[model samples]
Target: MTKEQPIGFIDSGVGGLTVVKEAMKQLPNEHILYLGDTARCPYGPRPAEQVIEYTFEMANFLMEQHIKMLVIACNTATAVALEAIRAALPIPVVGVILPGARAAVKATKTQQVGIIGTIGTVKSQSYYQALKAKQQEITVTSLACPKFVPIVESNQFQTAVAKKIVAQTLQPLVHKQLDTLILGCTHYPLLRPLIQNMMGDGVTLIDSGAETVSEVSVLLDYFQLANPNPLKKRAIFYTTGSTALFDEIATQWLPITRAQSKKIHLGGTTNEI
Candidate 1:
């Protein structure tokens, strides 16, 4: 694969833009292609098989564009489909979970950590397993914030409504004695300010999306995919839902130019990108 080819990132919704923002900052020379399955968003509650089907469909869409690498930016998707997709794909694949887990494992001073994600993500036990795999003795507490993604996706994260929702949802983790919290879902990073506020100054928050890009940078170099003799960066975003809403949220959270987002359907083989 050549560096000229864009790096692909996929998520259940605009949450993946968090990763795109970091990639733009860390890999300024590279191009980015992102697909948000907004049509079937909040993959949190979906069955694992359904999540995998959707993840592969998104990956196939990105592959058609000749991406050099794949970053599964959705926590639920990473939890359910990362391994299967990685094995099937020829290109290098990266996911948000391990990077965040690795960072959390290293960051926690108390050996007590917290993970907040979607229902599917938390139920799959991906983050907890990933954390334990890295360091067997780490104590983990996880919560599924089913309400968080809708707030972010609806472009209400900075609103009082969103704040109340975050506070209500995060009440449990506040007293968990955790020194570090993993924003396991890509969408959670969009709610980082609210989360950080609730978790307070003493608790460090880990954004899987942000951390995933660091690994992306390293992989790009290791795999000889770093763009050389680069030009101005470019980003192309696609969604299966309303482009207008995606544009609104992405403009505020990502480094992307505020343009009309392209719409693409990802389902059975009959669907087109």
Candidate 2:
């Protein structure tokens, strides 16, 4: 739990980079260690037990790196594993749901908030519960956008087809009179442009990943783990799947030019990766 120790972030895939990007912007001195289980991605449609298993696998891998803290950047994983991981680990653990809910509650003028996430996330009702916990009278509407993850993972986020899918998938929330919409899944922010267009300018988009960084900053300060050095630090990214695709997405989405990435295998007992 040293200040120089990198903060670990894990997700089903590259979507967690959205959170890493914000952390880089807000906590420039802190180093980052990111892991994306791309091989078992889109935890959206998977069963809750399976999602919990996979989430723990990723957490175990990050814990090996001696990260000062852990951020559950994936909404599906956060829905199922945040508590277990927090209890198991000595370091502080942060999840994206609570921060996004707080942001939506603060931003909403009409008390109507819409949430879009994966099937597992929606089924778990984590966002719904979090929002209600914050403000009981707030109206919450949640939808599952399972297809959105594959689009971002494949780097098709800017394509015309992606735009159409965003429009069609989010149509139900457009007329819900939501003043604020929480991008419950970390992957959703990469398609933020399309989502904003579909929901119109009046609907404020709350990026849960970005919001999670704010919480991370607070925790870092409170725990006396904030890095004292001001120099920029290189971020390390590892994917259980393709390093090529993961690097491509990281280069496009992240602001740093010297981002380093590698491929790692998770299931075997050997540390072959």
Candidate 3:
């Protein structure tokens, strides 16, 4: 695969932009094609089977774009669909869970680590499994913060209501005295300040998006897929839902130009070009 072929990234919504932001910083010369399934936003509450189907639909769409590689940017989708996507696709497929888990284990000074993510991610136990695979003695405490994604997507990170909801959702995990906290979901990083304030200064906040980018860097090198043009990279964003809302939030959080979103029907007779 040549570097001219864009890297593909897919998420249930705009959350994957966090991963794309990190990739822009790390792999500046590599063009990227990001797809956001905004029409069916919040894969957190969906059944595992439905999530898997949606994930495949998006992955196949990206494959149709001739993406050189695939990055499953959504934690819920990664948990439910990474393996299947990897098996179905010819290119290397990377996901956030394993990299984040490895980073969490490496950053933890104490054996006790805390994780907060969507219900689907937490239920899948992907982080717990990955952490245990590295060190059996490490203790993992996971909480399902289903409301956090919507709050960040709505651009309400610093609002009083958002803080209140965060406090309520994180109260259980805060009581566990964890020295390190992993922001399991890509959207959760936007809530870092609020989460850090609530968790205090001592707890280390791990952004999975950042770690996932590092893994992507390593993979690109291993596969000899690094772009030759170090300064001529471009990142493009697409969404199946509200382009206006995605553009508003993306401009505020990411350093990319305006996203050109196109409407897509799930499981219908429409093709993404």
Clashes of each: 0, 0, 0
Instruction: Please list the residue runs of candidate 3 whose C-alpha ends up more than 4 Å from where it truly belongs after superposition.
Output: 231-233
Clash-forming residue pairs, model 2:
none
Better of 1 and 3 by TM-score: 1
* Candidate 3 global TM-score: 0.96
Candidate 2 residue lDDT tens string, 1-273:
679899999999999999999998999998899999998898999998888888888888888889999999999999988999899989999998999998898889999999999999999999999889989999989999989999999999999999999999998888899999999999999999999999999999999776799999999999999998986555889888988899989999999775557888887441637
lDDT of 2 at 7: 94
Question: Per-residue lDDT of 171-272 in model 3, one digit per residue for the tens?
Answer: 887778899998989888888889998998989998888889898889888999888886554877778878788888888777756655666665764464
Q: What is the full ranking by lDDT, best candidate first?
A: 2, 1, 3
Q: Estimate the TM-score for candidate 2.
A: 0.97
TM-score of each: 0.96, 0.97, 0.96
Residue 80's lDDT in candidate 3: 87
lDDT of 1 by residue, 177-261 (tens): 9999999988888788889998899999998766788899889889998998666648888999999999998888875557568
Native-vs-model 3 lDDT?
A: 0.87
Highest lDDT model number: 2
Task: Please report how far candidate 2 places residue 2 from its true position, in Å.
Answer: 1.3
| Candidate achieving the largest TM-score | 2
Worst 10 residues of 2 by lDDT: 264-273
